[model samples]
Target: MKESDILSEALVKIKNYIAANKDQDAPIVKFRTPADLDKIIHFTVDTAGVSENEFLDLLDKYLEYSVHTGNKQFLNQLYSGFNFPAFIGEIFSTLANTSMYTYEVAPVATSIEKEMIALMNSYTGYSDGDGIFVTGGSNANLIAMFSARNRILPDSRFEGYDRKVKLKAFVNEQAHYSFDTAANVLGIGSKNVVKVKSDVTGKMIPAELEKNILETIARNEKPFFVAATCATTLLGAYDPLDEIAAICKKYKLWLHADGSFGGSLILSDQYKALMKGIERTDSFAWNPHKLMNIPLICSALLVKKRGTLQHNITDINADYIFHDIDEIEDLGKKSIQCGRKVDAVKLWFAWKYFGLKNYQKRIDNLINMAIYAAKKISDHPQLEMLVPRQSFAVCFRYVPKFKTDLNQFNLDLREQLRKSGKSIVNYGYIRKSLAIRLVITNGELLEADMDLFFKNLLDAANNLESKCQLELEIH
Candidate 1:
């Protein structure tokens, strides 16, 4: 078939699939054991030879197989459902197939990316800075840490830490795991990434941070980088960025904010206070894909120092690639990846589709939903709120009245919900205790959806309680 015909057919099929499954108010698939998966694979795949129609059918099935995370009840991971405008923009991005490196190849996309980065810098109050769109939050953090490493020890990249001094990157205990991962990838070792203690509310205690810095220095370790998490992954708490920035400035350390989850709040006037003193930081990792509801892989690493990343990572000096132009700073020179995807197009399109104020309104709605859910959970006698609602994620637990093997009960309840395929909610341990986590980052979700989720969650807990009682009686 012709490409146009194929594209039209695919779009139609996608529309049909979404329309049919959009109303599904529950999980799309139940947990399957190994034996069950073996049987399912044989019956579905082995029994029929593949054809175009069959392949499309499989596409529909597989697409809808997981918990419709984009569905109203999906509270599992950080990223939930798809945004309509961002989705459409992503389709266009794929069709364009442009690389972000060269303006000659992707002139429009390159300009859009630059403009978006400039807008983000303006939000952070960076006067003269530069940024680049990265694959995700993790990659952005890596690039930030890598740039900081190179800035502090200019010869480390080439000489492999010949300074013979232990370099340390500091982060709060409640910070996302990405900092540790970045440290490992940057060859700094996980031990060197000091975990400063966070208060009960999950904010990094500035005094503790300063003490740790002094201690590290006293131990003859080089303390040069500190990563402050704007919104923590587990509790959605924002660290005291202003105080942290003060300490960073006092020590002359490179301060980078991992605002992957909370960065979108920059658009909201009310929540922008959470990121106060962000402009003082050296670098920032922000993800529009998270709370902004843009498509995935749309994260940016903004640096206050204009050419710092270029100084660290730029190695390619081919005459053909680096021909003298009015703008000497090609984006490829600054980025870790050479042939990067044009990930900024969808975000630019999203911004265009929904104006900045409207986007902030969406963020405000999600934040309100989070607060509403926290209140609802707190009011429930059987449920206990683990963390205060800060941004969008609320951590809580279904604590039975009688504390008979509560951990086992909570774990079993979560497992039963997963097995039944009723709804998808996640449970995690905080401070060696189990708690359920609900992330309200999806802009498409409404208050009514949250009501349904809480209802189902309570029903699931009650069912698990009855089952446990029955087992106890039988025993």
Candidate 2:
């Protein structure tokens, strides 16, 4: 076939595939494992030949097989649904295929990314700031920690921390696991990550953080960075950023906020107050993909100081790259990555398509839905809530009226739900008690869907109860 014919055929197939599977709805896989990798690989690659038609067919099949999170019922993870404008922007980005390293190569993308970063800085209350797009929240966190590490100990990048300083970092126990992972990857021992205690609602205690900082200093350890979680993973709790910033200021510690899950709320009037004092922090990690409903792998690391990031990660003399530019510097000098994608375009498009007011309304809708869900769970006779809804996640479990072994019952119920493939709700243990967690960050979900979720959960529990009773009688 001619090249034009191939392109035309491919476009037609893609359009047909998307049209056919756009409205298909189903439950997400309640439990996932590599149970049939051989079959999956065969079906995905071998049976589906490399022809354009075959590839489009395979795409359609996979779309149908996967969870319809964009449907109004998906409340599984931090991210859900697709924004139409953002999707269009993503398509444009793919067609452009520009990297943000040099203006000569990606002039438009470079300017757009700089503008996007500046807008984000304004949202975080940082007037003069700089940032770079990372792969995701984890990579963003790593870059933030790396910047902090390099800022405090400039010699360690060359001499290695093994000989110069035993660097230590701190995070609240409720902070995301990525902090520990960052420390480990940065050669700062995970043991040095001081996990301070949180209150019942999961907000990190300011006094506890101060105490830990002093204790670490007393022990002759170099305490350089303190990471605060704007919204925790488990319960969506917002740490006391103002108080934490005050402490960090007093101790001269670099403060970073892991707002990857919660920073999008900066647009919401109801929840923006929770992120106060964000400007005082040295750096922040925000993921538009989480709550903004943008495509996956869109995260940013914002540093308060303009040139701090450049100081930490500047690379010069690439000969072929970094040629003289009149206006904007090459983004590569400040980014942890060398070749960066045009990930900011989607976010910029989303923000532009939905004005700030509309975006704020969307966020407010999710928060209100979360509050309503929490109340419904609390009012339910058989359900017990672990923590109140702080942002958009409600942690709760099915608790029977007369069960002394609630933990065991909850754990078994979670397993039964997982095995039954009815719905996917994760389980977590708090204060030695097991509880089911329902996260409601999906922009597409509604109160009616939450009603169905509760109904399905109860049905699953009832079925499990009957099975348990039958087993007891048989034994």
Residue pairs with colliding backbones in model 2 are: none
Candidate 2, run of 10 with poorest lDDT: 17-26
Decoy 2 TM-score against native: 0.91
Superposed Cα deviation of residue 257, candidate 2 (Å) = 0.5
lDDT string for model 2 (29-120, tens) is: 43445565344533544653486655555655565456555654456678877687887899899898988888888888888898899988
TM-score of 1: 0.94
- What's the lDDT of the predicted structure labeled candidate 2? 0.80
Estimate candidate 1's alpha-carbon lDDT, on a 0 to 1 scale. 0.82
lDDT of 1 at 323: 67
Candidate with best TM-score: 1
Q: How well is each residue in 336-401 modelled by candidate 1, as lDDT tens digits?
A: 787999989999888899988888898888888998999898888888887677788888888875
